[model samples]
Target: MKEYNTVFPNLIDDRYFFQDISIDKLPIMDKYNGMINVSAYTDAAEYINAQDVTFYGAWLLNMLEERLIALENYLVYDVEKPELVSYTNTEPTGVPVGYCWT
Candidate 1:
């Protein structure tokens, strides 16, 4: 068996930096009948508010942007790098064509 080791600076290690939030019994009325029901309810989102952060957080964001740019470049790759050749095939009788059409 073989093992690989990876190391990085002891930076931010908290994955779930934001807390989970739940909004129950949210108002969701039917547009046609104007009737409210439990089936018509919606959910509020739990998101990270990055208003306050350290320099490490900003540096992580910059690294993410660079990675996204690299991914975009890989997606829009052009396979055809050469120009097509042009040709002419005609007879001296001014018939204007030859085996090029066949």
Candidate 2:
């Protein structure tokens, strides 16, 4: 996997991503059923630069596409080789069958 710094060089030393802020400390409230509100804390422009966002978005899309292709290949392998599938019994004594891809 690529390091965070390698993917986002400009954000390497940025505190927003690295800082461990507790979610409980945030100004959040359940106003209604399935509805919530939270306060904004950072400068939007600093966090959402067009160039950086675009680059990261494209990179994320590419990574997701690659993963999807890999998963498709694995599924195809399972379909092609039914004899290779096996089952294992867990502590509860339930058998779950699955393909073991190397």
Candidate 3:
């Protein structure tokens, strides 16, 4: 018979207590120029007071702005009234082009 190790998601280790570890082991934070003392009680208050950060120069914002302009153009100018668009031999249903409402 072969032996195998079993893994479970919510298992807790018995050897190490969380309070036994010091905060100095944490990597230096560029934002604060120091390692964070990750006490749940203290950090929760600090996080509440911290200002929101946004990536204003992100590419997705520019792409979304462009999409908004294209959508505005599509809704305002590119749309043809159903009666104006000449689909060969098909009668206009009077709804806007591409909206197939009965």
TM-score of each: 0.23, 0.26, 0.25
Which residue pairs overlap in candidate 3's backbone? Answer: none
Go through the candidates in order and give the clash count of each. 0, 0, 0
**lDDT at residue 93 of model 2 (Cα atoms):** 32
The TM-score leader among the candidates is: 2
lDDT of 1 by residue, 1-102 (tens): 111111112233334243322233122211211322233322211011122222223445655555555545545562333323335464323333332321
Q: Which 10-residue window in model 2 sums to the lowest lDDT?
A: 28-37
| Model 3 alpha-carbon drift over 4 Å, by segment | 1-57, 82-102
Per-residue alpha-carbon lDDT of model 3 for 1-102, expressed as tens digits?
111222212242122122332345333223322223444534533533352322122333554555566567667776674544454566555566555532
User: Which residue runs does candidate 1 get wrong by more than 4 Å?
Assistant: 1-56, 78-102
Can you give the lDDT of residue 48 in candidate 2? Answer: 37
lDDT by residue (47-92, candidate 2, tens digit) is 3332222223344555556556655765776456545444445332
Tell me the whole-model lDDT of each prediction, alpha carbons only. Answer: 0.31, 0.37, 0.39
Which whole-number lDDT from 0 to 100 does residue 99 have in model 1? Answer: 26
Task: Look at candidate 1 and give me any clashing residue pairs.
Answer: none
- State which candidate has the highest lDDT: 3
